[model samples]
Target chain A: MIPTISVFEHSPDRGQGLARDMSVRWAFEEVGQAYEVRQVSLSAIKQPAHQALHPFGQIPTYEEGDLALFESGAIVLHIAEHHVGLLPADPNGRARAIMWMFAALSTVEPPIVQREIAMYMEHDKTWYEKRLPLLEDGIRVRLHQLSSRLGKADWLEEAFSAGDLMMVQVLRRLKTSSVLGEFPNLCAYITRGEARPAFKRAYDAQLAAFIGKPPKQAN
Target chain B: MIPTISVFEHSPDRGQGLARDMSVRWAFEEVGQAYEVRQVSLSAIKQPAHQALHPFGQIPTYEEGDLALFESGAIVLHIAEHHVGLLPADPNGRARAIMWMFAALSTVEPPIVQREIAMYMEHDKTWYEKRLPLLEDGIRVRLHQLSSRLGKADWLEEAFSAGDLMMVQVLRRLKTSSVLGEFPNLCAYITRGEARPAFKRAYDAQLAAFIGKPPKQAN
Candidate 1:
């Protein structure tokens, strides 16, 4: 049986494909793998059923046969391990690619996520406006270092591996912000990632799922 | 030649073994692998030399032969991949073990680090005190969910694989805070992990390095 992944019933990203599941979807497309989707509502995510799938009650848990996994980065890695296209065949190349995956999730994403949390949850607080700059500055530090490292390279490595997919997904969070614009190369890098056929397929699928959803009728 | 990991010449954790390097060291100890240490000063970390090793210029870059990798999670996984004790022999179990490693770093550690950032960086800001509880609450939500999942279990999984090693390291950051006390099971889990001979050996070695460091000469 093919893998099935759980996603938000109505994604908070409004079909922009910013949710964690986007990476999983993108990985599947790159690998020519077929998968099913299981949609869970925000409230339903915390219920026992969802919690059993993901202890943290977050969406984008992957299941195939008896092996189920949580964490988008891990799921992507698993798909990359089982699939041919997502990772380099060489041992050292594979290690570095996986290293970039950790860098994307562990190092780059946290600050961006912190910024998002402030925008979403802390905006009404007295500290909202004051804290926003600090959060943005944090994101800038990571982006600048990443931009410097990227230079003229099209991807983080020799070819577009899962690392780039993960980094591109993480960087996509900054597309709306002026901060990402400061790094011209990074901006262009994101464009290249979004331009990929696999990424387009995944993005279109997630967006279609969101738009296909019927708006809730008034009770 | 044994792998040599770069660590902070003066660890920000002040020898508490909370630095990112701790995971790499602990992983080495767990697998009974010996390693060398290369200490870099704070300013040195941002220089091109360190940058070449880790684009982000973070500590805990592992180097052996031609393979050099960064991100503590990735380094630990690399070690686990080559060694036997850190990962289960089965494919699915190994997959889940790596999943928890991502969960610890990507999910669990971010909130805790956010709280820490505020404590150290934003304490003087006008919103510091006011914003503190919001961050703590964010952490509490994760801890509560984690506590529930960890109820009566010694680790996140059946055996002490790399997953537990990573999770315990992430959770240990909370030990000095009041928040971790709310969940006795988690506290016990940390205790169990820290009690391991491997963990103690790694902790002692890192701690010794910190204490052994000579104070900077006065101008």
Candidate 2:
């Protein structure tokens, strides 16, 4: 049986492919694995049934027979471990690739998310204008480190492992902001990730889900 | 040879066990692995050699013979995957444990870090007091969900795994904040994790590293 993954019925990103599920879907496409998506609405996501699958009431849970998993990073890792394309076979290379995954989520993404939260949740606050620069600077620190590391490399490492997939996805969240554009190499790095054929397929799939979806009012 | 992990020579946290290295050390102790620590001062951490090991130039990098890995979450997972005590042997249990590792780092730690940034970076601003409640509330939401999911259970799942290790570390960040006390079960969960001999050993090791060191000025 094909593994099942859950996604937003009406994604808050409005088909921008910034949702966590997009990366999971991209991983599946990269591995040539066919899976099914179960659409979940915002309200239904917090319900008991959904909460059982994800304690934090978030999206992109994976279920394969008796095994269940949440957290997109973990789900992507699970897919990468089961499939060959997303991770390297060499022990050291694989560990380094996983390191990138953690860096992308834990190190890079948090500052970008703080900026997102400020824009979406606290835009009306008096400190909003004053705080935007600090938020941007926080992201730039990470971007500079990432750019230095990505210097002239096609991917984070030798190949486009799940690390690149996660890092690229996290960087894409900054598409609306000018902070990512300051580092030309970083921008090119994201471009290369988006240019992947598997990424295109996954992007199109998430975009299709957004079509005919009533625009989400709440995140 | 024992694996080598790098940590801050003069940790900003003043040996409070909030630094990411604390969890990595805890994981090692949990698994009964004897690992060596290489102390990294803040300036040295950003040097080329350090950046080669960790792209972000952060601490708690794992080096064993030819393998080098960074990111505390990844290092902890690496230790868990290789050791018996940190992860379950069964496939499903292991995946769930890893899922919690991601959840703790990706989901729970972000808000906590955001609050930390606000407090440390923006404390003198006029908006600090007004925004402090919002940050605390943000933490409360996650704590509430985690507490509810935890209920009276001694651990997150059937037995203590790396999930508890990561979660407890994440929660310990909130020890200074009153937000953690709102959820008694979560507190007990942390208390239970701390009660473990492995955790005590890890905590003592990190604490010992801070002895006689002039307190760090920069984060």
Candidate 3:
């Protein structure tokens, strides 16, 4: 049976892939997994039914048979584990790929989230002028470390696996900032991920969902 | 040969297990893996040597043989994958558990971190009062969903696995807010995890490291 996942009925980002569900959709598409997207309103998400599947009442909950899971990382990881394309075959390489997955969510995403919160919620605050730089610096520090590790390598580690997929998604959030432009190689690297046929399919799929329509008729 | 993990020589949290390294230590203690801690000062963390291991220049990088990894979730997940006690034998069950690990870091921890930033960095802002409540509500919404799902269950899933270890650690960050206390079951759930001998061992070890001495010359 095809697994089912949840997504916003009307995304807050209009048509952007910034919502968490985008990652899951991208992962599913990459793995050739036929999945269903259950549209969830923000209000319905907090209701008991949704909470049962997702303890945190967030989007991108996955269900296959008796197993129900939440968290986009977990959902993507599950897809990667069961499918062939998302991870490496060698044992040590596989473990390293999983590490990159964790690094993307835990180490890299936090500061990006902080930047969003600051921009959205703290713009009017008296300290906004002063705190913005610090937050930016915090993000730069992580990026610098990442850029250094990434160096001239195409991906965070060898072989673009699910880890790189997730990392690219996280870094894409910084596209509006100058951080990505600061490192020429990282910018090209992100561009490469975005240019993937699978990523394009996922991005267009999410954008379609937001517009309340299917993909535009192909030329 | 024993695995080696990285930690702060002098933690900002002083003796608290709030540092990311604590999660790695807890995983080691749970799986009965003997490990060594390599302490790095804040200055050295920014240096090239440390940056090679952790691009983010954060504590709790893991190394076994030639492999090096950063990100606490990645490190802990790595340890869990190799050690039997942290994951389940069932494929579906194991995947669900891993999902909880991501949920802890990605969904749950973000708002809690926001609360911290608000409290510390923006305390003097004119809009602090307005912003704090919104952040708190954001956290509460997640907590309420989590509490309802937990609904008197002993753990997030079937049994206590690495997922629960990470979840408990994430929730513990909100202990000071009284938001967790609002959910009686969740509060008790965190306490139960903390009371475990393995958790205590890890906590004490981190505490000892921070206090610049052994665990208070245990009674």
Return the top candidate by TM-score: 1
Per-model TM against the reference: 0.96, 0.96, 0.91
lDDT of 1 by residue, B1-219 (tens): 788889999898899999999999899988888888888999999999999998998899999999999999999999999988999999999999999999999999999999999999999999888888888888999989989988897778788999999999999999778998988888999999999988888888888879885321101
Docking class of 2: high
Tell me the tens digit of each residue's lDDT in model 1 across A57-129.
9989999999999999999999999989989999999999999999999999999998898888888888787
Q: For residues A1-219, what per-residue lDDT tens digits would candidate 3 score against the true structure?
A: 877888888888787788888788888878888777788999998787987787676787888898888888998888898889888998778888988898889878899888887899778877688778878887887787778778898886677899999989998889888867887877878898888778888888789888888542111
**Second chain TM-score for model 2:** 0.95
Clashing pairs in 2: none
In TM-score terms, candidate 1 sits at 0.96
- Name the lDDT value of residue B201 in candidate 3: 89
Query: In model 2, which regions exceed 4 Å deviation?
Result: A213-219, B212-219
lDDT of 2: 0.89
Best by lDDT: 1
Q: Candidates' DockQ values?
A: 0.81, 0.84, 0.69
Tens digits of per-residue lDDT for model 2, A1-219: 688899999999999999999999999999988888889999999999999999899999999999999999999999999988989999888998999999999999999999999999999999999999998998889899999988998898998899999999999999999888799999998999999999988888888888963222101
Q: Candidate 3's C-alpha lDDT? A: 0.83
Candidate 2 residue-wise lDDT at B192: 89
lDDT (Cα, tens digit) per residue for candidate 2, span B28-128 = 88888888888999999989999988878889888899998889999999999887888888988988999999999999988898899888999999899
Measured by DockQ, the strongest candidate is 2
Local accuracy by lDDT, each model: 0.90, 0.89, 0.83
